[model samples]
Target: MKSIIFIETTKSGSSREAIKTADRLGFYTVLFTERPNFMAKREEFPDVHFMKLCDLSDMNVLQKEVKALILKGIEVSAIVSYVDPHSYTACTLADHFNLNHFSTEGMKNIQNKIQSRELLKNSSVTPEYWTVVTKAECKELEPKIKNKFPLVMKSPKSTGSKDVYKVGNLIEYRKRYNTLSTLYENQPILIEEYLPEPQYLVEVVVHKGKVHIMAIIKQDIQYNRRFIVMGYKLLLNPGVRFSNGLMKAIKEIVAKHGLETGPCHLELRRKGNQWKLIEINARISGAGMNNMIKAAYGINLVEEMLKMALGNDPDLTPKFQKNVYMQYVTVEKKGTLEKVTGKRKALASQGVVEVYVKPRKGSVITPPLSMGHRYAYVTAVGNTAIEAEANAKKAAAEIQFWIKESPKEKITTVIQ
Candidate 1:
């Protein structure tokens, strides 16, 4: 039996997908994470093991620990991780074990958003309307600059939609900038032109210099300027199509930066007839975007990564599903206790595949819905794209958010 190691195997959809892939590959997969306690929470799966690694940034210590694990009779063949910070650790471990892996340079280029953007610019694949801002110097920036308004401000190092802001004017830009700068303190932010078309994300699984599209997902956010993503659905939209030119640009950028192998999630924006490159991710994205893409496309990217790590080529074919949509339930306001209506009835709706609800009736909710803050999520599939999207929306609408209005927004007392 082959043994594979996954770094940062926390309790996430990615972790669940890894387990599924391990089962499919029939390998003894060991997962290393910061939270060893996560092992106690999950139900048992045969041939799956969980280990813990502390402080992914501590390279030397991690090396010594891996050596110790090897000495302790753990037969490890390949190293893989679904998280950004852990990609470097995976590369290091793979090199130490002499397993087929992406080079250290590749990992760095993809993981560092700044480096990735620079590479894109050098290859002429990036758009012309993007600017990087350091926290200190950002105060001097004119948010209403004639050049780059109606823009997106994003954290270079963030994963998912943690601190992204869409600013229309100078006031909004400065307000959001100060809020983020005060919270994060000196981290770099990217301000780029906000493209008007639907946002499309492509998941690429690169093995031995060959790249395959694992999935294509279209994202939906709560509002235009909100950083938090409301949900994402599989891309079956007619408008969503990749061209040969864009593919060549991506390959050139990846090759130039040495992003030779691994799972990458690249975001692209379409303006009129031209496709512009957004930032690329070194690792898999949050939500089950990759899995949905695999289920739709029949290209098992996780399984391919596993095979690549084991020095094998993946079998690829065009496996495409008809239509699918995934959505998240977000609260409208903050309150102590609330009631969710029509949950059981919604679950029985046609084409509803799965539903995950985190908050009970009385759970506290936060604004700008994030990865773990979502009260619930729904994934649906159907014969038509519109049907699938409607099913997800219907299911989400059933879950009511009965929140009490905050004192600041209250107008009743003032009028009285």
Candidate 2:
């Protein structure tokens, strides 16, 4: 039997869901991760093969390790990944095996914001961007920085808006730059034109060079010091005028990037008539959003990813069973996660499928600098966008992140 290789699963029980899908489709799972301590006993992972690597980030070493296994006559069917760190590995290994996959180099262009902007320099979608690697570079770029006042600063390679900030002037710029410099210690910092919000997340699945619009997610974003993605409401009928135009632009953009197969999650914003590009990730959205997509559209993006991985066709044809669905969640200020309130109330609400508050009592909480820090998640569905959003909102409002204060000195996070 052929084996499906996962560089690392994003979450437990096979991160990609591709693993389970592939397993059900008659394929074995080969997991390569740095966590040798995890499931130390072979019996703990039934029908799953595990391999240890000194460093999953060392591409050469990981490739060599896998090549050694291949040399031993192990038959593998496909390569798939869910997280960012291992995405390149999946692309590289798939390319090595001559499997249908996107370009690894193409992924690099977008992963590095500086390179991504360079690629789009001549395109209409390009934004004015510069890299500040040194303090001296910061001083030198002040003129252009001031010209494009209210600039957005971010790490060249980052997600969940970790160090992303908006600065109106030089002082604010210096403060953000210094904070980031202190955090990253000389890593490349990106400064781009601050695009207006009312942001949209487009989930696109590409197979055999064909692009499919799976779902256009609407996000309620809060950018007060921290870029917070509060929740999302799936727009079932984005309308022909919107869909046709957006799809055309996306198809052109994907073709421009030379993205081949698999899932690509795009962050978009429309300023007036123009659909501005925020960032494009060559993987599925993080934080179980795939489940939300399935709940709304009756399409499993992960399953599509699996099909594409195994050289099979995906059913992109829409089976739009329902109009709206949502996944609502929240993060908390610095404190210990005490008790959760209104969970039962939320669960009992109509159209609310489930409620989950991740942190247990005494679990410390911090500013949501990344997706993992999110406190809870609620999945809801309804016939209309308003109803779905209301259900999600009510459920979210019902649950509270009751936190007890921790010593301010104990918090070493910069977000504070």
Number of the top lDDT candidate: 2
| Model 2 quality (TM-score) | 0.88
How far off is model 2, as Cα RMSD?
A: 4.1
* Candidate 2 lDDT, 1-416, residue by residue in tens: 57778777644322646666666777767878776655465465554655454577777876776676678787777777877767767887778778645667766555666766677778766566888889999999998778788889988767777778989899999999998898889798988888775889899887767888888988777666767777777887788888887887788778777777667888888766667788898788876577777777678777777877777788876666564555545554678776667789988988887666666788888777666667677778887877877777777677766666733322221211
Off by over 4 Å in 2: 12-16, 35-53, 67-73, 338-345, 404-416
In model 2, residue pairs whose N, Cα or C atoms come closer than 3 Å (at least 3 residues apart or on different chains), thus clashing, are: none
In candidate 1, what residue range of length 10 has the lowest lDDT sum?
407-416
lDDT of 2 at 251: 84
Candidate 1 runs further than 4 Å off: 23-26, 36-48, 122-124, 129-136, 139-147, 236-242, 335-347, 359-363, 369-371, 400-416
**What would the per-residue lDDT of candidate 1 be over residues 243-331, giving only the tens digit for each residue?**
55556656776686687767677888766656677778777675566556654666656666666667777666656665878777765
Top model by TM-score, which number? 2
- TM-score to true structure, per model: 0.83, 0.88
